[model samples]
Target: MINDSELILNADGSIYHLNLKPEDIADTIIFVGDPDRVPEVSKYFDDIEIRKGKREFITHTGHVNGKRLTVISTGIGTDNIDIVLNELDALLNFDFETRNLKSEIKSLDIIRIGTSGSIQGNIAMGTILASEYAIGFDTLMQYYQKPYNSKELEIQEAVIEKFHDLTFKPYVAHASERLLKKFAHDIPKGVTMTAPGFYGPQGRNLRSQNTYPHLIKQANTFKVNGYQITNLEMETAGIYALSNMLGHHAISINAILASRVNETFASNPKEIVDKAIRMVLDRL
Candidate 1:
């Protein structure tokens, strides 16, 4: 039996951080980074059943076209992704009363619908792109025992070689082939670079100076085995990495809201995100 500290549950028996019980979610889940966007996705649901939240995590479970779906917000960053994924897996595969793992594990289909900035000019603003692979420039994966395949290792090695002077190492993770084929096969697919922050880590210099001034330029030119860093975002790599580790199928569908290459931002960011949301919902 797992100890209380290891598998912490609420007084009501829901998961600690997510404030969600096993029955509160669906097998197919959509993840949004912003809490406000939680309703944006859930609005399309035919009917919403359960709504729960705590901190930056807000969850809405419902159905659309007779298909059950759940949309939850992870706030931002891979750090939140760590908590969200683990707790979600626990809800699905752990017996909360027993505080133990179930005999049969269940894998959830996780789809991330979020906004991003295109690093490449060809990927215009308002375009919907799917991340076939994501390279994390964060330290979240370092704490996990991640095993990479030959393709993933090659990409990781290439990133390490490029950013050799960096203090920490980067990790590579791919989207689930099943989910990718199911939801994003027809769309433009490329590599996404998941930064730790919006400003410096993403090469954005507002009032502060960036250590790597040419970071975005370098990312635009980066490529390995035909996969280039196409866009910059904050969550896909974490989502993909943790999903892979937890035996869940995951994919990130990005609505391009900014263009680093063109130096432009979407005039109607909500409309862009809405289009992506509808596409995913229709596909789902």
Candidate 2:
């Protein structure tokens, strides 16, 4: 049995951070980084059965075209991803009363409908792209016992060699092939660079000095096995890595709102995001 402190639950028996019970979720889940976007996605649902919120985690579960879906907000970064994914897995695979793993475990289909900034010149603002692979600049994966494939290792090694001056070695994680193929066939797909923060980590220097000012340039020129880092985002790497660890299928669909290379922000960011959301729902 898991210890109380290790697997904390609310007095009402829902998960601690998300305030969600197992019955409140669906097999297919959509993750958005902003809480307000939960309703944006859930509004399309034919019927919303559950609405739950606590902190930055807001969840709405409902059905569309007879297919059940759960849309939830993960707030910002991989740190939140760690909490969200672990709690979600616990909710599904553990017997809350017994605090023991269930005899039968289930894999969830997780799709992240979020916004990103393009690091490459060709990827224009308002374009919807699917993250095929993500290189995590954050150290979230360092705490986990991750098994990297040959391609992932090759890319990671190359990234380490290129950004050798950095304090940490980046890790590579890929999206689920099943989910990628199913939803992103017609859209552009490429590697994503998941930065730890929006400012220095992403090579943005507004009021602060960036230690690694050439971060974007280095990542843009990085290429391995015909795959180049195409976009920059906050959560995809964590989502992909944690999902992989928990035996879940996951993919991130990005709506490009800022162009890092062009140094331009989209005038109609909401329209692009709505387009991406509708695209994913249509595919789902």
lDDT of each: 0.92, 0.93
TM-score of 1: 0.98
C-alpha-based local distance difference test score of model 2: 0.93
Minimal lDDT window, size 10, model 2: 145-154
Q: Write the per-residue lDDT of candidate 2 for residues 205-227, one digit (tens) a residue.
A: 88998889888999889887798
Model 1 residue 126 CA deviation (Å) reads 1.0
Screening candidate 1 with a backbone cut-off below 3 angstroms (N, C-alpha, C), the clashing residue pairs are: none
RMSD each, Å: 0.9, 0.7
Number of backbone-clashing residue pairs for each candidate, in the order shown: 0, 0
| Alpha carbon lDDT at 192, candidate 1 | 94
Q: How do the residues 1-284 of candidate 1 rate in per-residue lDDT, one tens digit apiece? A: 99999889889989899999999989999999999999999989999999889999999999999999999999999999999999999999999888889999999999999999999988888889999999999999989987677889999999888877678989999999998998998999999999999999999888988788888888988877788899999999999998888889999999999989989999999999999999999998
